[model samples]
Target chain A: MAIQREHELHSRRRGRNVAMGLILGGLVAMIFAVSIVKLSQSQSEDSTAPNYVPATAGASE
Target chain B: MADVSSIDTREYEAQFGDYVELLKPRVMRLVVFTALVGMLVAPVPVHPVIAFASILCIAIGAGASGALNMWWDRDIDAIMKRTMGRPIPSGRVQPGEALAIGLALSGLSVMLLAVFANLAAAGWLAFTIFFYVVVYSIGLKRRTPQNIVIGGAAGAFPPLLGWVVATGSISVEPVLLVALILIWTPPHFWALALWRNEDYKAAGIPMLPVARGERVTRRYIFGYTLLLIPVALAPSFTQIGGIAYFAVSLVLNVVLLAGAWRLLKRQESDRDADNFRAEKQFFGFTIVYLFVHFVMLLVEATLRAFDLSITALPIWF
Candidate 1:
């Protein structure tokens, strides 16, 4: 009975750690996803910007 | 029957779980996030698909480093309470197997980045893996109290690597991002070390708290936390951030400094339940503090691109 109780306590402690890890991991993943989406949106916006100066002109000048 | 039992014991070691507890997944997420931010914030424009490839390579490289770190630290890990249940220590994974996996992943990640991204990004990725596995884990971790201070540079590389991926070169912005993370690392880690000093002592690892007295360690932690505020506020002066980031940085730094001061001033005997709880809160807040700072930067960059005036903070040239 004592051995079983100790085992249960060990598993309980492990469960807590795992839960904390999972929560933190989920938050990190969400942040990464948000950053990626924002990056994509920014890139699209940049592509639509007007290019008054010709790409080759600056190099030649 | 006894002979058969002995033979069964030899054959029945726990199997490895590649999908779980490799520490790869956790480290990979940090790498991906920081690198993505770097790519997005860079002055040079990168193609969307190329950017994706760059983040992916950085993630793989980070994972490879984690695997190598696991392999190398397996021995020490088995003795430490915190790491006692890691795959290798728990007999779920063999050291040789981990070594092979780490090497294979390291080569593949670097080569893929070199081909798909730029040589500079790939070079940084390779160096990151080398620094984590060789310089930090093997050279500094066991030998010095300044382990995290120097090893922190290994973790700081992802942002710089990401910048190179986008711009095909390095610059002041990425260096500043690297510096912010490097400065933040010691306080973040030392707080945990303070609480878990006993485990480190038992494991014979030369963490700051284990090597130096806890009083000295607390002073170091306070000093780092104080230094981190200025560095954290640095982005606000740069073109990357604005008044919103500056406000957040100011308020957050005050809170962080307060926590560090409290931790620093507490007596040895007073490191009981309440004190420990306070330290834990500080540690948890530190994580959110960093995430919020980075997220604000990302938001500011997006606003700048749109020519939207969120705040009138001066942008450093």
Candidate 2:
């Protein structure tokens, strides 16, 4: 009975660890995705459309 | 302290599993699910990482409350046949150990949420844990016939906490969500209490059915079910829910009210011969009732987000 209980305990702990690991892994992946989305939006704005034109270009003048 | 050399390491390690069991994972699932829905339907979007961490914290806080409840109620748990197999009651874990783990996890979850989310959400989470452990479990549970009626607030906080995590502010919509849970709780729990009256009696706990008699309890259940209908429908009038949710809530509430009526009309013989099948079915449907409401709200939110909502009622309506 003691040995059986020990085995069950070990199994439960292993299951817990696996579940926790999956949750942590998913959180990391989501954060990475959000970062990519934010970065691309910033990059698109900076590269495609400048907020200001150069004085020499005379667009503003 | 006992000698380290004399301690049995293998037995000590096995006890760790029992500590997890004390957290009441089944209850934690509901806490997480409802909290997730709360986050999903909030007016402002939460960052994915913050949402994930906050929900995790909410679940941990819920588990912490469960552990603390178990720590406090080990004696009664041992007496009740339904709870006799719990970790502390079964001797798989010690009372002091449960208390320590509960306190530790309570602080950890609160601190983690404060760091990952806003202080308001974390503070609400802390209050929820305290309410469950101190106000409900220790104070009122064994003392009053209205224990579940008052104690149910602790169970209903996850959605409000989730909403706060997302928006850092309260609104009538989330307050209505909390109100829906508050009204729905009595009938949901009373149905279980109807069948489990024996367990409460054996444990010397003052549950409604045991204290006020089944007839009165059934009447209250029917009364609360009737009250829940208007509250559940009110959200659709607000911006939180739309046509799909309105239809769903109407149907679910009707079914649950029918069940409550049946439970109220059940003969004593029906309760005895069939073992309160009406009560049990009402309990089962109540779970479905609550879950489906949130799921429909989530669906409405998702649809509105994509500007594909065909089921949104006119704002004036």
Candidate 3:
């Protein structure tokens, strides 16, 4: 009975540790995905050549 | 069904499968599918990797809502024949454990969605969870006859949330998609309610057929079905849908309308063991109806994405 109780305690501790690891891993993945999206968005914005229509080009005289 | 008093968590140890059961995988599949349609139909291109991550977050959020719903409804669940085997009610998992998992997954899903997609998408996901878990499951469920009508919004919001995640904004297209689901839910659920009236009555849950008579519920089923036809067709006229979608919608809605008509024409006295075939058939068809329309939308979007002009509507349209 004592050995059984010890085994249960060991399993519970392992489960807690695994849960903590998953949470930490998810946080890291979230940060990484956010960084990639932000970076890609900024790069796209920068790459797009702005249309600079001359102010007077279409003005009627 | 075990009496709530007789449920003793100490008798059963939680298994890995119990946690999966808490997610309500069947409902999650529909949620994920609709959300995927929302994402795919958006005008802006989403990177496949980013899209995958966003969808995963949405799925997790939906699972969280299911867990929370099970937690909140565990008592009524214990009494109902249909829900007797759910994790909490079956005594496989403790209520405290379910609640903790629900809350944990809820926060994680929301934050992950916000980071991977836009905050608007995350906000909508958070609201969807809150609406399902709190507003529908807890607040309106036991109190009103119109519970399913309002509660339906929680399920409808996923596609719109998906659209917002992809585009980082809301638009008429997504709103129309949400509207379609919103209108469709009543007839869908009410049909099930008609079939499962005894379970609901036994649980003292005020479903339409329980609160109102089956006759009233049947009338509502037809009325909502009539209302749904127009909403289902609305998307075809918009920028999102084209000739292919219009043709699909026309055929599907007419069949759906006919199904409703059959239900309406059937007498309430016909709800005997041999004759709920109409109800069962309508309930089954409604699921197909929603899925087909959304899949057609995805087809239209894909056609447009590839510049496949053959399926495109005429220039005048």
Q: Of the candidates shown, which would achieve the greatest DockQ relative to the real structure?
A: 3
Candidate 1 off by > 4 Å:
A1-61, B1-16, B273-275
Which whole-number lDDT from 0 to 100 does residue B297 have in model 3?
Answer: 89
- TM-score of every model versus the real structure: 0.80, 0.83, 0.86
Q: Clashing pairs in model 1?
A: none
- How large is the C-alpha RMSD of every model relative to the true structure? 10.1, 7.5, 7.2
lDDT of 3 by residue, B175-239 (tens): 99999999999999999999899999999989999998888998999899889998898887777
User: lDDT per residue, candidate 1, A1-61, as tens digits?
Assistant: 1332333334434654676688569645644654554444422223454433334232101
Chain A superposition TM-score per model: 0.48, 0.51, 0.50
lDDT for each residue of candidate 2 in B1-317, tens digit (9 for 90 to 100)? 43334544445343345667899999999999999999899887876756787898899999999999999999999998889999988888878888998998999889878766678899999999999889999999999998987788899899999999988877888888888888889999889988888999999999999999999999999999888899899888777788889998989988988888898898899989987877888899999999999999899899889987775476532
Each prediction's fraction of true contacts recovered: 0.00, 0.00, 0.07
Better of 1 and 2 by lDDT: 2
**Best-to-worst TM-score order:** 3, 2, 1
User: DockQ of each candidate's interface versus the true one?
Assistant: 0.04, 0.06, 0.11
Q: Report backbone clashes per prediction.
A: 0, 0, 0
Q: Which stretches of candidate 3 lie over 4 Å from their true place?
A: A1-6, A9-61, B1-11, B310-317
Query: In order, what lDDT does every prediction score?
Result: 0.79, 0.83, 0.84
